[model samples]
Target: MSKSAIFTGLVIFIIIALFPFWINFGKTAPVPEPELVGKAKTAKKCVLDKMDMRANHMSLLDEWRDSVVRDANRIYTNTDGKEFAMSLSTGENSCLGCHEDKSKFCDKCHNYASVDPYCWECHTEPKEIK
Candidate 1:
């Protein structure tokens, strides 16, 4: 083949190989962010304050439990990513349902292994309120 013909063929091959990536790049629809309505922050604070005032550890952590449940339900429904590979706890229970009673459940494994969980980073501690 002539030199110009060979060059044109190579250029066409390269474009064809890269076409799929270029076609998919930034092609997804943009996700809409949640709109913050009036008094949303204040309403959340008031609800959390009421939970804190209830004097029960469970009530204090109820917000975190609800958040986890909602996230799990979303994952279960979507099943679009790797979430479909793992198991989710769907029952009406929180991680506290297992971790709080250390002597009974958590201690049996986590205590013996001397491992600390990152859960408390966001979730409330089950111990007496500090």
Candidate 2:
């Protein structure tokens, strides 16, 4: 090939290879690892750690209430601490909302996990599987 043609081809190849590097230059600064910047509160730590744990279905609801709903109630200062669904009359949000069947899903999973949920202490039902 002619020297001029070869040089032109080489320049094009170099530009094509380096184009990505230059185009991304302005926004390509390495994102530094997120700093553990602030002093996390003990409650926050507990909540975060609890988030990592695998909770049985029943315990999940209770944990959700304690870690999240209760915190929301505290922060929002709402009259109703229990954020039950509109159809729910007893406990905050019907168990059937997620588990479908208390005995079938909730009890089965909890029993398999060897967890006796304390949910019965505060809530009761008509023994009707809805």
Candidate 3:
């Protein structure tokens, strides 16, 4: 083929190959942040600060689990030296006491972040009658 025709064909090939990128350029919309639900909205406070809870909740839960099961320590002391029962199932001073609705508080964020926590698999979740 002639030089001009070859050059034009190459340019067309490149444009066609990158057509999808051009079409999608700057079209990305940010993912909508999941909202906190149920009692979490009105709760007096959380076990950890908002930012700490959001970042390290899984690790905290794991520590709680090990403390209760392996170390046989049933009482948890917060930063303020307030003690609470460390039972995950009973929902007394643990996670469920304040955030009673797992579907709302826990599951919403977990699903949004694509994390599948196995805590609910073995532990029976407290049922909300309403």
Q: What stretches of model 1 exceed 4 Å from their correct place?
A: 1-92, 98-100
Rank order (by lDDT, best first): 3, 2, 1
> lDDT per residue, candidate 2, 48-96, as tens digits?
2333524443344555567545465422121435343322114333434
Residue 37 of model 2: what lDDT?
18
Every candidate's lDDT = 0.43, 0.46, 0.76
Between candidates 2 and 3, the lDDT winner? 3
Q: What is the lDDT of candidate 1?
A: 0.43
TM-scores across all candidates? 0.25, 0.32, 0.66
Write model 1 residue lDDT over 13-33, tens digit each, in one string. 999999989898988745333
Best by lDDT: 3
Model 2, 89: alpha-carbon shift in Å?
7.8
* Residue 25, candidate 3: C-alpha displacement in angstroms: 13
Clashes of 2: 1
Best of the candidates, TM-score: 3
Better candidate number, 1 or 3, judged by TM-score: 3
